[model samples]
Target: MIVTSAPRTKQILREVWRPLALLFVWDVVVTVVYFVLPFRAPSLPLTLFGSVLALFLGFRSNSAYQRWWEGRGLWGLMINASRNLARAARNFLPDGEAVDLKRTIVLRQIAYVHALRCQLRRQSPDQEVLRFLSRGEADFALARTNVANGIVDGTGRRIELARSKGWIDTIQQSSMERVLIDIANAQGGMERLKNTPLPVQYRLVPTLFTHIFCVLLPIGLVETLGVATPLGSTVAGLMFLAALAIGDDLVDPFANTVHDLPLNAMCRTIEIDLLQSIGDPAPDPAAPDKQGVLW
Candidate 1:
């Protein structure tokens, strides 16, 4: 996720460089056209068109940002639920069974977080995930098509075993079940966001309008500015392109881009918190150098 800091003007400028280059080329082309063809100055209608295009770009960007924020919030809930579920398991189980069963459940929950992260990023569940489960259990999960679901299933089985052994009462079992349900719901919400895309028609509308405005900008300025028509057109083009690119950048929140939610960091956080709660030695933190280097 983007850190809350003062705006990075240098980073924003670097991101806009490509559009700026394109704008320069566009201005040159417009200047040549103005001299070679019978072009007239822009009309009032063209200025209004540019305004409408700007509004469309703004709206699209705002909508994409909303989706990205909502996805991040859902993962926040998952982190809380995982910790709570482990606490409940430890608290409600019988003293004799509590240590082992609680540890097992806690580790499984950690595995679930890692598995979900891998699934969302379309990567394989690695050895880090296996470290959280028993050899047999890990092998079983590795054989499954959905590692996240497999982890949840293992947790449910452990819960059932605890109940059968009289380690937990019916009420405690039910509570644990509810927590697992919440985890599943959180997973489903994320999948929904990952799978569903913004409507194509809506996406196309801004690009079409922006391009139209860019094309007509030179004609409008040429009559008034002469050779400077290209310069004016380039400036206008860069502005429109910046708006469009920003909107495009936000359309995919789950991507492993700098602009995306820090899923790997979040999963590591869940691991550290859950393992610490169960008295296990915490793993060393991953390198923080690339924490915010996504595109």
Candidate 2:
């Protein structure tokens, strides 16, 4: 999602401001209480709490990163699968009445790529996906709840038809079909990542604990830091809260966030690869922007 050389300080501020604000508010409240009833700093073991929080944050970050990595890996597999399918189409099917059918199948694979991207992001595939399909095919895919799955089903059906008509023999059909199945597996893997979220504890527990530790941190430091407690607490709170925010963003990698996989660009890549194989005009691949962000 976020592909910049460095995320802007302003953007970082935007993400952690809420927690920072709470830290500031809580710090002020606690400061006033500190004056009323001077704090016994050593009474609260800040070191022990900090260690526990560190372990939790590490676990949470690792979990979210795994999900993000899995989604990216699935897309990598999809890209390879698309290329394989295109290669098979050009080689397996004999050039004749089946030419149109081969073209349709190859083109629809592009549609399937775009459709799956849209599906995972919970977006309408109207403009992007429809263009890849014929009027009738587009209309059918658009009407369906799971457009990507429908397109894949159509692909399998086309394979069957091509086999029955002897455009491709059983062996060729089976080989091409194997690539289709790999693509399907990649699709299913991404869909699972999109549908199944990180566990509830992963979502809630660390965040709650992080906030608790942040709020209590300044209180424990009141006696030692005195007037500097607020500043120290604010900095510490922002750091921990920012980490939590990043983990939260990464956990749902298909939500089309800045930190998400570059699905649009990746779909375009599949389009260019498959279309080029069929001697069709395809768009040039795009590069990351000047800041090396948002490719």
Candidate 3:
């Protein structure tokens, strides 16, 4: 995600420049037709349609933003769950075995965050998952369809083991187990967001309508603007085109785009907090680079 105050114009343009260029070309064509043939469409009728398009586009953009917001909120919940899970281990278990167990669980929780990040981004866990688990465990997780869920299951089993060994009381066991459940629920929520996108037909309607409106807008305005029709249409087209671009960027929050939720930074935040909780030195918090991207 973009964490910088000023996002790079070069990167921003790389995605939507094609449509802007097409809008410019369309404006030129409409202008040439107006000058060469003495033909014009009724501006009032198209202007009214533009108003409806604006309202429709606004609604669409809101829906996309809601999805993005929900996804981000789920990750926030996961971060808290990670901390709570570690804190439970620290508070409930005794010394010696408990110390080793707490450290193992906390480090594995960190690994879980990184593994989830990699899974959501459709990348291999590689070093992150292997860093916490033994070679055999890492191999087993990597071979699974969902590495994050697998890691969570492993943590749950460890808690059960600790309980069976009488390291932690049943009350403490249940408490930690509840936190794990919260973690699982949060993960499921995010996976749902990742898997269930807004319908393509719904996305296409506004987009196709907006493109058509942009292409035809100058034809309507040429009778009034005369020589300045191209300039006026260019400005109008840009506004509408930008609305579409914003909605498109927001609809898929986990697309590894600049507009996405900064999962990498979020995972790093959880890592720092969990490690510090376990008496380990914290790593540097993830920050934006010169380009202002956190990932």
Candidate 4:
């Protein structure tokens, strides 16, 4: 995610330059046709059209931002649940064989967060997840279609085993299980956002109308603006186009784009906190890159 106060001008230009150039060229052609041919600028209801288009773009932008925010909220839930589960494992589970079990649970919580991050981004978790698990256990978890869910199931079994061995009482087991359920709910919400896209009409209609409005902008304005129509029309067209772009950028919060949630940084945070809970040497928190982005 971009952590800067404002995104760089270079980055904004890089994203929109192609469409901006096309709009400029189209505006110029419309202006030239008005002057060279015996054509009359149509009295298009540009103000009314612009108002309706703004409404459409506004609704789409709001919906996209809500999806982005929901994804962020889900990750926050996961982070807190991870820390709680690790803390419970360290405090509630008794020592002896349970000491090793406590360590296992803590490390596996870290693994689970990283695995969930990878699963959201549609990447392999092998490199980030395996180091935290035993070879046999990692193999078993990775063999499943949903690796993160598999890890959560394994953790639940371990918690139950501790209860059976009298390392933790039934009440303690139930509390930790509640945290796991929260984690699972958060993951399910994230998967729902990632798998289900915005309605096709929301995406398709606004884009089509935005481009069509831009194409007709100069033709409608050429009568009064004359040679200045290209400049005026291009600027107006860009506003609508940029609004359209914002919705697309924010629609998928887990696409691994610069606009996405800082999942990698957030996973590392869980790792550091969980490791420290068990008196292990934890790594430093993740820092943004030179571009002011965390991934």
Q: Judged by TM-score, which candidate is best? A: 4
TM-score of every candidate relative to the true structure: 0.89, 0.94, 0.94, 0.98
lDDT of each: 0.80, 0.84, 0.84, 0.91
**In candidate 3, which residue ranges exceed 4 Å CA deviation?**
7-12, 40-44
> Model 1, range 1-295, lDDT digits (tens) per residue?
5563656556666787775776667778777876888856455466688878878998999988888888889999999999899789778876574678788888888988988888887888867578778778777677789888878987899899988888888898999999999999999989888888889866999988887777677767777778987777787787787788777767777877667888877888888888888778887654444434522
Please, what are the lDDT tens digits per residue for candidate 4 over residues 150-226?
89999999999999988899999999999999999999999999999999999999999998888878878999999
Q: Which stretches of candidate 1 lie over 4 Å from their true place?
A: 2-19, 35-39, 42-44, 284-295
Rate residue 143 of model 1 by lDDT.
75
- lDDT by residue for model 3 (82-118), tens: 9899888888877776688778889888988899888
TM-score of 4: 0.98
Q: Candidate 2 overall Cα lDDT vs. reference? A: 0.84
lDDT per residue for candidate 2 within 148-260, as digits (tens), equals 88888888889999999988899998898898889889888988888898888888889899988997898888877777788888888887888888788788888887678
lDDT of 4: 0.91
Choose the strongest candidate by lDDT. Answer: 4
After the best TM-score superposition of candidate 4, give how far the Cα of residue 160 lies from its true spot, in angstroms: 0.9
Q: How do these models rank on lDDT, best leading?
A: 4, 2, 3, 1
